[model samples]
Target: MFDVIDFLQTVGQDAQWRHADTEALAVALTEAEIDPELRVAILAGDEQGLQALLGQDPFCCLINPAKPDEEQEECDGSCEEEEENDNDKDKENDKGRG
Candidate 1:
């Protein structure tokens, strides 16, 4: 998973947001793909809010925003399982062809 704090640092360093104001930073974060709540907290300089928001898996879309502290880890597990199944199928096909 990508580091939320690192991503935020990169965003802050980007030319577009280099000298951006609070509103601009918020817009940039919104456009960057994740929810705008984190941006809102950052602009407001609310450390606790930022930490709380970051606690959720930011990259996961299935995350229920209502429960920001708990991550829906099932998605990751299911994805890995699906990938393994695909690999196994490929191996079986190779064996059949051989």
Candidate 2:
């Protein structure tokens, strides 16, 4: 089996490959010795099909950190509150043990 990840990386890095026509992409996929099913999925732009073939589930996660200068005070207040609550819980547990 051809390395699907490497094939994807090659296509991703090359604008020409990424924008190639279906016929041209089919030729390239043939040259790359890609799996027939994967070639079909790529040609059809089938994200779910590609994921199934690659044994991957559709997943996305994004994290945007707050600006330190602008959000620091807000974060500090909430974080300190959570810490104090946790500390209180710990103290309560310690009293129970004693």
Candidate 3:
């Protein structure tokens, strides 16, 4: 997990306007760190909460977007499982030869 204080400190060093308010943000991050559910909720929002917390626009795919692939889900590594089976067969052949 990214530490909010460290993130804020880095932002403070890079931007002048940020340096002034990062101290406050650091304190807010302490509370945010303790409450993971709140943090997840905040991260799930579209823009307003993200802009306030991260100082940038949030582009969440869940919000203000079209459903491009409602039916299609990403394939999990089933192909790799098949490849591993092939490897096991090769190992068995090697053992027979030895």
Q: Give one digit per residue, the lDDT tens place, for model 2 in 1-98.
A: 34877888888999887667889989988998899999999889999999899888888899988777764344547888999999999999999999
- Which candidate number would show the highest TM-score if scored against the true structure? 2
Against the unseen true structure, what C-alpha lDDT does each candidate score?
A: 0.72, 0.86, 0.57
- Best-to-worst TM-score order: 2, 1, 3
Q: For candidate 1, write residues 1-98 as lDDT tens digits.
A: 15557768797678877677877766666666556676667778888788777675345356436477776564647888999999999999999999
Model 3 C-alpha lDDT per residue in residues 23-54, reported as the tens digit of each score: 45445656556344434433453346545555
- Per-candidate TM-score against the hidden true structure: 0.41, 0.58, 0.24
Ranking by lDDT: 2, 1, 3
Q: What TM-score does candidate 1 get on C-alpha atoms?
A: 0.41
Query: Which candidate leads the pack in lDDT?
Result: 2
TM-score (C-alpha) between model 2 and the true structure: 0.58
Counted clashes in each candidate structure: 0, 0, 0
Error of 2 at 59 (Å): 2.2
